[model samples]
Target: AAQTDAWDGVRALRADYRTATGERREVVLGDGTVLSLNTGSAVNVRFDASRRLVELLAGEILVISGHGAGSGVPLEVATREGRVRALGTRFAVRQQDEYSTVDVFESAVEIRPRDGSGAPLLLAAGRGAAFCRHASGAPHAVGAYADAWSRGQLIVDDVTLGDFLAELARYRPGVIDCAPAVARLRLSGVFPLADTQRILNMLPNSLPVQVRSRTRYWVSVEPAS
Candidate 1:
């Protein structure tokens, strides 16, 4: 991507705060908005007295827009897929290889795809949009993502056990994998804020699986006896 107009600090191309290929960081913007960047993320900052823009290069970001930023000056987060103009909204964006997931927790946002979708997608609170890189998406419901972020819980609604575990591994750092024996197990319910332990402990009782903890950070799930 070519650089934007004259960047900060006399640099041709400027990124407000950038991380390497495998680094994660937390950035606090001048306007009081906080961005929690997942691994391999880069963001260009455009914060002034009037407008606020965050251009994400890669990875995931958890955003909490500050209160009372102004009346008409909305906050925006842009990525390779499109731009998100937040109307006093709190949302998160995850840009991966295949698609980008936009989860809205509060207020509303306008999602504009660069592929020339004249009608931008409007997502309200507790809604989400998944933009497929290869093709257009059906715009299904992802209320779980939005609700979970707000309540600080992980609600897996009838998802495959493998898929459930795969998601649980993201919040925490380490290698936590599921065995094939429990791959087909179906799961539901909520995992409270930062409480992977509680979820792991209850899995065996709720489903036909055996959850064995190798360590506090490492766990494995298999078919029950």
Candidate 2:
């Protein structure tokens, strides 16, 4: 993909930040907004007199509004699908393939789709929603471990093996593939993000699966022999 300058408008100063695989980072904006970027995430910060905006070019961010200079300006996190306007709150936004997910942890947030086709939705505390270009899903209760990644942990609650591996792949440098035969196996555990290889090694003991490693950068989970 071609990289375009994020600060292309007049008087628009922008800063870009990114984290490589298996890394997490924090960024403080000029207006006192702290953003926690997850692994392999990228964000663009643009602040001016009129608006305070953080664009999620890729990945997820946990935003906490600060109360210092330039704090009164409403903070908005823009994704490909839409924008999440912080309403004196703390929230997290993740940019997905087809849509973006917003989870509110404190206060409320207003979501506006990019195409401006549907009514804007206000998500209150403890709620989450997904939105696309022209529509949005209704707000739902926040999941048990929706924000656990920020703590360097993966909390699984009877989630499918494939789904768990898919999430785990986001934190590592290479492929972690699950064979089709074991994809539907159920799993529940707390896997530490600090050691992804250990997680792969321990899976076979707890489940009917085998972890095959072609190299450190390539691995696969298949039905146990």
Candidate 3:
């Protein structure tokens, strides 16, 4: 589930860490920075005399800066949207198709948009924000359970069935189609990501929907007849 690839480039040694679907991994970089990757996550790392940089290519990661070989230099994590400069802090970053989300758990972080158009924004602890190439949203309070997934649990509070399934899909393989007719049903609970099948099985007992599995790779939810 965890793979490491390294190669020497013209400037320095570059390493790539990736986690497969349904897998979570933790990696410690040469500089002592710890990265906890979520399912289907990947991070490319490079360190030199000048600076330390981490490129988040896909999925989500929780970063904890460590005092190690390269601890003197500032560490930056970049996504397509922009860059997040860690200020001796712990934070989480998640990449989307057109944007990226950053949640600050301790201390603060400085965000700079990729387009270089807007002023850099400072996000403090207990805050979360989203940004794209052109714009960044205002910082908002992070939910208490925002970091639950890192503990192998998914916690939802009055979330629609559709929204919850979309999130669950990230930790699962293949497709899980939720019918529009049942998408608006609301539910709240803490489900263990390690046992996805158990969560699917319990859905029928709580919600007025039926789970139909055509194959192990394909499943659907529809209104129970």
Candidate topping lDDT: 3
Clashing pairs in 1: none
Q: Is 1 or 3 the stronger prediction by TM-score?
A: 3
The residue ranges of model 2 lying beyond 4 angstroms of the native Cα positions read 1-15
1 or 2, which is superior by TM-score?
Answer: 2
Write model 3 residue lDDT over 47-129, tens digit each, in one string: 89888999887789999988898789999999878999999999999988668999999999999989868679999999999
lDDT comparing candidate 3 with the true structure: 0.88
What TM-score should be assigned to candidate 2? 0.90
Per-candidate Cα lDDT values, in order, are 0.70, 0.87, 0.88
Worst 10 residues of 2 by lDDT: 5-14
RMSD of each: 6.0, 3.8, 5.1
Q: Residue-wise lDDT of candidate 1 within 154-191, one digit each (tens)?
A: 77778998888877776565666788877977878878
Error of 2 at 35 (Å): 0.6
- lDDT by residue for model 2 (85-139), tens: 9998889999886789999999999999999766789999999999998888988
Output the better candidate (2/3) by lDDT.
3
What ranking of all candidate models by TM-score puts the best one first?
3, 2, 1
| RMSD of model 3 against the true structure | 5.1
